[model samples]
Target: MTQPHHDGPRTSVRPRPAGDPAATAALTLGVEEEFLLLDPTTGESMPVADRVREALSGTAREQSRQEFRHSMVEMVTPVSPDLAALREHLVALRRAAARAADAVGARLVAVGATPVREAHRTVPDEPRYHDMSRRFGPVAHDPAVCGCHVHVGVPDRELAVQVCNHLRPWLPVVQALTTNSPLHDGRDTGHASWRSMQLERWPSIGPTPHFDSAADYDATVRDLIATGIMLDAAMVYWYARPSASYPTVEVRVGDVCPTVDDTVLVAGLVRALVATAVDEVRAGRPAPRIRDCLVAAAHWRAAHDGVDGDLVDLRTGRPRPAWDLVDDLLAALVPALRRHGDLDLVRREADRLRRDGTGATRQRRIMAGTGGDVRAVLDHLAAQTIAG
Candidate 1:
């Protein structure tokens, strides 16, 4: 099916003056991760999410739910005030989901997309899924991917709208760090994040638009809904948005990371970013005048190179090494990090991720060592998924 033509968001980014450094505070945060249910011996994805959910203990079941694909299940951490608590919650959830999948004779893997040789997973029996499948054909059927979503508490939707702009440039940086879907359908896709490529195929998925206020955001959303480009507000696939069900800013960008440490690292960065953005907004600073096409270009390249190649330096409009951008982002967030007691964690993990490389880098290394066997990649992913 041909997707409707909607040029992402044409809202003009207005220039804002540099203002005083405002107060920063650590925000309560949560994480939602999706995992693939695979046949342990065959390394093929299976439509067994319901069985895994049934096998989960009551508490674990409460923290988990089904994703778009029946071969996938998602687990969410409770609201956490610190990275330590976030790590504990994420680890427990990963273990619980892994144990449940094992009980149902499957392996749960934290992959952005299935490395299995086939794409045959089914959707759950739900009205939303049925509507999506009927409306979009294979576009809905073939999304065989999973992602990690982080929610950082904000005071209000208006503030969340403002913070979204502050987050625009940093989205690509985070994507570069968590590029897990380097291979798809048992073959190398060339792009470090094949999942990102598949997702942007949707008409509404891309950079978040600049908004004048919360009312402007709501009106634009209504206009887009009237265009029939999206089913509802929930379908707006911008990299960042105000939560529909909670008072928080949700950054739904990165892939499902391979381990609890990765999740915590991402959480620390996201929380620090949100906190930093909140400070900027309260200080009367306007959002940056970044072009939509430039943001799109950066995102595409980030998906292509992960952290191994150069990226467009938006500040200078020139190419720079990807890890340099990551470092600059870390440097910008130091104040927020210090306020949140995450300075040490962020510094240490940034060095480690840079040294160890991203998930895509690690997956590529595994393929090389195993003579390009996709099955071994899945095996390694399954092992790492719950190792924390």
Candidate 2:
């Protein structure tokens, strides 16, 4: 469907401050990560998010928040203009969160989903969460899934919308790189990202349709809310969207990475993608015209196979090796990466992930090597989560 050409609510882009070094920097970005709290010995999900929050009261309190489930906690970093600073901030936040979880007799696991949690019975004490539980029933409570959201600065709402359109086809490639959930409810789901499958149960979550302008995007979101399909703009859980609370475009397609380096790699690549999109817009290039259905199929294929199998390459609408797609993605972002002085770091991290396998592959290997012991899988995840 073509987007309606109408001017509606818009956020004005502000001019950069004189002599502000950040204005000349590549792109400011931030990452939000959700983690599962688990008992150290049994590897079972622990409903101690409130306790962890209390433990983090003084230090890093602003950076951490409670998720929908009591078994999950989310950590967000401040805006960072470069990869090195981003890594430092994220690592410190992870360490502090780990310490808080440890104080509550639980450990944080950065896997996409808890392997042994059959159900989530403890919901946060927030009113919004209560409403969600009442409205969604089992699907809301069944999710112990965690994910990583990357936000790249794009102050102009129009440019942000255009960037989202340009970014639609590449999101599946990001998903494939960060597939960390394989086992669900103590059994292999035969999919790399079982967390994604669980999240897809939501009515408003998935690939987004093309929007010609910010007004078109706003109209679509308003229409969905008007139908009572979702509560508000926050519920528009597309893989990529303009952030409602910030002047940035948020990429919500990646699983919560198990290792800090993986998170940094994904963040770098996402920033590069946003930069590339912005450059395209400046060059008067229209966004790619791939159909929403094709984009959705690509996401499904990536979530199903991850880096271990073929993905529906958006360039040709044909299946291709996931690794090859990753290479192509890197090639597409080379100019942006080089401009940002992050090409070497991104390349090294990608190579490392390719050699060692993604979190999903490693989790499967642990399960197989341990004779299908889910506890061993949890142990590996915990170790990796604290490895940085």
Candidate 3:
């Protein structure tokens, strides 16, 4: 894609207002899930996206794209009116995607980070991924990571940028709670979500600053391009950004959870969080700093302990037990949860995770029983994908 002219003035282009009830109700939900292709029986990385794509061509309803192409594939569900519909679309699409993979002597596995990724690996060359690897060099070539992204539609571009900026502080919280990648190259990386550290190697990855308007956001994006650090706004790989082609802020921090229920709950939480931020901004309420800092600390804890460490209370900088922080986050998000009509689903999944722990916990347990056999772990991951 050709770069845009860089002559626009950099000025704040704030949205109409944040909390207008009219604006709040105008939001919509979408999801972008990444999957790994692997040998069905041996559970090793497999470049089967082409075959999967060929099988799904003219068959699947979701918009499937060759994401890092070959070893990884992504499917985007159409924007749904509510969380329930979003969940339904994703569930159906995942099932079909899995089936397509199965037909090609491969299986689809949903993961935050693949257990045995070699950063230097590349799939069969495709123009997009090829250009990406050429542009990013090592960061794009790294084959060990994957993630789950949620896109909530904003009524206007300015609102979308505001929502993305306000949502930054909490980005780390979502990262920590959804931290799932525990193994890399068949061994523990000692980080809950190794993917976060892996992505940090890219040029524009991490927490983003709040922008006053779409023009300000656009100007900031232009700066990244002029510096030659990224090819375009779409490549600005920050944890969140106003999607270049869509009227939404894509939340890119969460790890791919293991169960269908957890996926739904996480989706609900993301939608609610954005809605809440949009509302608070409209009300002229100061954005919450605790939410921002806690999110960063949460990423640190989750990376180190994988749901086993203490996360700081965003409000006081005091460390709180991980479980307690999870509880508090859920409680604070209740209003947003209710608005999405996903309060019950979020509660159910949160309760399950609280009692059983996140998917990483389960993967660890299975590995222990099988003597650190990653193939066994892959079995669990593959089974979980179908269950979704």
Q: Which candidate has the top score in lDDT? A: 2
Order of candidate numbers by lDDT, starting with the best:
2, 1, 3
Residue lDDT tens for model 1, 166-275: 89878888988889999876778999999899898787888887776777788888888898878888888788999887799999889999888888899899999998
Better of 1 and 2 by lDDT: 2
Expressed as tens digits, the lDDT of each residue in 1-388 for candidate 3 is 1223445323233344645567558468888888888876666678777788888855363488866646777878888887678778778878888888888988888877878744437745667667777887867767657788888877566666667767755565677777778888888787888888788788677676555557766777888789888776668776777776787878888787776667777778888888887776566555543443455565666566655777766566677677777777788788888876778888887788878877777778888899998889888888887684
C-alpha positional error of residue 74 in candidate 3 after TM-score superposition, expressed in Å:
1.0
Per-candidate TM-scores read 0.93, 0.93, 0.89
lDDT (Cα atoms) of all candidates against the true structure: 0.85, 0.86, 0.73
- C-alpha root-mean-square deviation, candidate 1: 3.9
The sequence of per-residue lDDT tens digits that candidate 2 reaches over residues 195-214 is: 88988889889987788677
